[model samples]
Target: MSWFGFGFNAFGQISGRDRDGNDGDTSIVYTPTEIKCHVDEKSEKSSELRASWSRRASLHLNGGRSLCLAGSNSPSGICDTGCTDAVVGESFVILVFPDRFESWDLDSDEKIPIWSMDVKTLCDGAGSPFNLPLIPGGYIAMTPPFYRPLSPHLKATRLALGAKHSVLLSASGAVYTWGLGSHGQLGHGSLSSEGQPKVVEALWGMRMIFVATGGWHTACISDGGDLYVWGWNESGQLGLPSRAVRKAPKYQTSEETVVTDLPTCGAQPEGEKDTQVFISIQSFPALVDITPSSELKTVGCGSRHTAAVTRAGDLYTWGWGQYGQLGYETSRSDEPYLVEFFRERQLRVVDVTCGAWNTFVSVVKKEVATS
Candidate 1:
């Protein structure tokens, strides 16, 4: 219910202070601190925080039926089996392994239990077993990945990730995508790369509820709010002023004699010129035009920047703002910029989050109407 963190904390993962209480510059905090939640007298407390990363973080409660994780310590088991550091129970899935945290068990295959001290004396069956001191972290549960592939009835409501690609949003609004599509980011206009989940047929009838991803680009938010974008727009971050890959003129068999490789600037300056050029990358989803009445409620991404939040709360930002994180002082932008520092103090930024370089906002102070 209360958490806040800023970008990169070398490894203490936002000051969990393992390297001697972080007295020696673990690197970068730049503001928004306060993210310290740990209380496991042996597990069973998480209330819900979902997912995060600066080092690692996760939590869940009955809806997901209990789950927990807490930063740094994945010794190459590839994030999730024996969760090499911090772990919590019931239906595991947590994955992210650049430095720590791993899990798997969705049902069980046995190998679990690794929080040491002989699994806390086999969960306190007691024979005087209380020497617990392995807190350097690591836990191992098993099971999970059976590869259902989708279509049992198609129920996913929302999910997004985009360094490697993956988007899924169906509760009927349908819009699915699968891993790494080179650059098309799986919108499917074609950079081709999918293993299973597919659906985005140029947004079929269009319903998309919400989705976001950056590093390679992909964004979606429509029920009527509208705002779509596609794969990597170099720095425009898909506010789309221009970053293209349009070269479609392949043979339509005419009688007007049309030969083509289509690149001629040699001798034609008379009256017709619409050759259409620019090839930076944008495979499919493209419809970003904020302020045609502004309705967006949420969207986030950063590995290249993008943020949105406005059901009247206002907070917009576009790609790569160097270190200012798009709040201003401008280092980069492609259009959507309205960060006025909590609208100059009346405060109302409801929510926005990102951290490939930094950005996190969530404000609320605005009530005043005295007699």
Candidate 2:
């Protein structure tokens, strides 16, 4: 069977492989550098097990300068090593065994694990469970919470996957969700799995559009521009008073709570309404999207802060700039403050993507007026 090797270099190149032999097509530039590779032992032998070459290997440079790899042992046994310039407290290690998935915090050297069910258990005497043969060359993106799809069509607009997890969208001033929906993120009141696209039942009759997911918690927007959140509300991520998590997921179809409930007083102007929002409620403090207009858009989560982009194309960030992931100049605050301020304020932003801690935006240039 063939093996898979995946990783990102400093120049932002991605590479990977699965059981099938390698073709050079899996290379991409400026993609997230983190990588994962899988191999199926059922495949034949004679596959060359070797490290894939990278065009821009220099980008893999880390302050800690350590190199390590881990996975099932067929080509070789478990591989781990240490190198120079590697950040002592920032790197992570992953180990995949035949039956278990383990992740490590190399900085602290702690092992975190997730269990993988045995093939028999997963199959229940069936031939086999649904499994996708690992494609060795897939790239990885460094996303917050988890790696989520970011469609350029939904730039500045928020989108998320639900529990019965489906692709959810807030576009053209309406909420649309399509995918698994044993949970009510689809907005259909009944607890049923929707194989095809359909408007949410509770939201079916309303002019509401826009949706966000924090694991199970979901939030949506209405045609009147009001916000509605339901599903798992643990840790107040739903911005509602209810602390109980919903088991039989359904769209909580009322104006139950608004986005304003998320931020404390003075986060926004009085009587200023939110036009669009995204919620990421994975852990700690949940993320809240605050888009006042094309010019004023902000995102914040957790205990220490918030982030916003001014209409002028300037990026402003506050709250939890500790890791410099906020793209700020320094990390000295426990409260909200501006970290990165762009000098060119007239640029128009076509899109913004925010992870758990870092945010990315695509902008377009504007012609200057010649006086």
Q: Model 2 Cα displacement at 60 (Å)? A: 21
Question: Candidate 1, residues 1-371: lDDT per residue as tens digits?
Answer: 33444445554445522223454334555444445545344444334333233434334332223234444442222223222223222244443222333444434554542222323222222121211111122212223331123455557666665667777777788788887887777878777788878988888888888887767887888888788877766566666543322233564234322212112113333433443333246677878777888988878887777888878888787766655556666566667878775677777766666756656565667787899
Best by lDDT: 1
- Candidates in order have lDDT scores of 0.56, 0.33
Model 2: residue 113 alpha-carbon error in angstroms: 29
TM-score of 2: 0.32
Please give, for residues 1-371, the per-residue lDDT of candidate 2 as tens digits.
11111222222222433114443334221221123222222323211111211211111212222133322111222232221111111233233232322334433423332212222233332221211111011111111222223344432244444334543443454454555544333445433456644545445456544444433445554544444544433333344332232222254335433342222112434453442222222211122333344234323232222244444555444333343434444442322333332333444443333333333344546568898
Candidate 2, residue 120: the lDDT equals 20
The lDDT, on a scale of 0 to 1, for candidate 1 is 0.56
- Model 2 regions lying over 4 Å from their true place: 1-164, 167-198, 201-214, 217-340, 343-347, 355-357, 365-371
